[model samples]
Target: MNRRIVLSGTGLVSAYGSGVAPYWDGLCSGRGALGPARRFADAPGYRGEPVGEVPEFDPRGEPRKSAYARAALAEAQRSARLPVLPPGALVILVGQAPAPEGGGQLDGEEWELFGPSAELRPDGAAVLHLSHACASAAFAVALARTALAAGAAPLVAVVGASVLNRYEYASMDVVRAVARTAARPFDVDRDGISLGEGGGAVILETADRARERGLRADLTVAGAACRVGGKLPAASDPGAVTDCLRTALAEAGADRLDHVHAHATGTAQGDTAELAAVTAIAAELDTPEVPVTSHKGAIGHLLHISAVPALAAAALSLRTRIVPPTPGLTTPEPADRVHHPRAETPYPGLRVAAVNSFGFGGNNATVVLRRD
Candidate 1:
């Protein structure tokens, strides 16, 4: 039906704090939030690695992931002026498989979905769970748009959360993916990811419905594309990323992008591959100087829910016409084609922005957003 979908509201709870204001401010301030990880301090094999942890979070007898989801969802609905979810509204819960209890590898049956869907979904509401590693949230956004276009629901609320837990932290530690200090995306001396925990939510609806409800619709979900490269879990393929970005741009009918929210996780392989992909796409589109930024440097890698914060940053950039600086980025690796800004910059021609999210097992997704 070619229905037009728009982002009506967005909520974020990150290492900086809850609410969009704090998150945006922290990003724009150009300071890394990586600090000592207290969550796993006393656990065996703990090595005092740094992490971007949410402060003062108390789950209060509920799963930390569920608590984060509920907080973010509440803010999103309130921002949309939706006191109650409309009947038949679809809720997409995006995240990774819960950390195994008491250590040891989890079996297939232990991979059941977890989130706040049980508490948030209203009567007649349908719930869907997506666990595509780091790209889960971006994939969820794309699915929500599709459902709305197909008239399967009047609206969709996509909520995602990834809290640092013992088993998951140990897994990354075992692989040496968790940075000893901080994540420095695009930097030549970059090491590994500073894992973070938080939640994010976005409300999407048709432009017609937003207008009918007298809600502002300034950002449009212009395009989305997801792909899988047959690669190892920890490796990234530049070719796959380039293909995904090209398809997303094609779907958006955009020839040039003003800004690119990158998925650089500070790993040597991941950052290099993403840069190669962006360089190729920039050359193909003749936007060689497209500004590229990554939130991982500021908030650390949020893992499965990382895309939500990046998407929220893209939406805010589109609205403000300013690109936030990449925190922890100093002495960026030489890039001949694209500009990686270390300071906040204004993009007078800002209109279209792309958010990239790459996950374990070569899952890649790109979402193109347009300012209306």
Candidate 2:
């Protein structure tokens, strides 16, 4: 049986603030939240790059990642009206672990930071932790769809969180991937990525299960694809990304797309490569004027959990029939093939959207969401 997977609820915590309202508002406002680094401003390797730190977040006591994850999960549960995780529920935690020398991985000694503890997981619930760099959340969603199709669980909750720590900051600085100011995806003068910290969660269940629970099941996970392009950590293959997008659309049986949430992280190579793939996909779909946007310009790159916000944005676009604008895009690079909106655009026929997330090591993932 081909089980239909649907997105029942979504929760997000970004630099704008907690909840979907604030995040959506921030995106539509066409303004970025990136500012001076508050946590690592005085770090040894810090070069005064702006960051998208969560407002009023205190990293003094408990792990900031854990707190963000829990808050996002709580919001997701509330949105789904799931007071407690049901028996046999599957929880997928997505995050990247710090280097061994810098500190133990989040799933290792720092397991409590954002592990599937008793608080987040019930007695019969199963847990899966994914640390596949930036595409971790998209991979989790793909896995959740597979598991639901196989009847492994009635529903799946995917939660991901990442914070701007000194170690990661230093690593980014070393790679020169951190932008000097703010992220300007697809802009002619785009520099690099602006790091951001936050958590996001999305609840997925089979269509039958959602109907049983009396939850709205309009937003469906039409398709998903993950592809490994090359060995380089910071570089991506346009061909691989094109194949990934083609496969996702093929799986979704979609010939047209209403919106595209691209993984343009403001890096010259990354943005250009993604634009090439997106352009190819647009040409294939015969929708040369397809609207595309990137959340990184506003929220900064969320690293391992980047896909969550993109997925959230795509889903909300389907529901609201509005395409959110891309922030920090002043002079768009010459791309007449696609429309990059800098202001909120109404798409009355918005029914299908694709969210792309390309991680280090050429880990590229795409999720096609549809509204019935």
Model 2 lDDT per residue over 274-345, tens place: 788888888877885888999998888988889989988888888888888889999988764688887999
Off by over 4 Å in 1: 98-117, 231-235
Give lDDT tens digits, candidate 1, residues 1-372.
337899998888888988888888888889777788776466555678778888887767566777888889889988888888899999998876534444246342232234443555678899877888888888898899889989999999998787776667777889889887788988999989888888899999998887777887768999999886645454378888888889999999998878889998999888888888888988887875988899897777888889889988999999888898889888889876889877778888899999999888778899999988
* Local accuracy by lDDT, each model: 0.83, 0.83
Task: Give all TM-scores, in the order shown.
Answer: 0.93, 0.93
lDDT of 2 at 328: 92
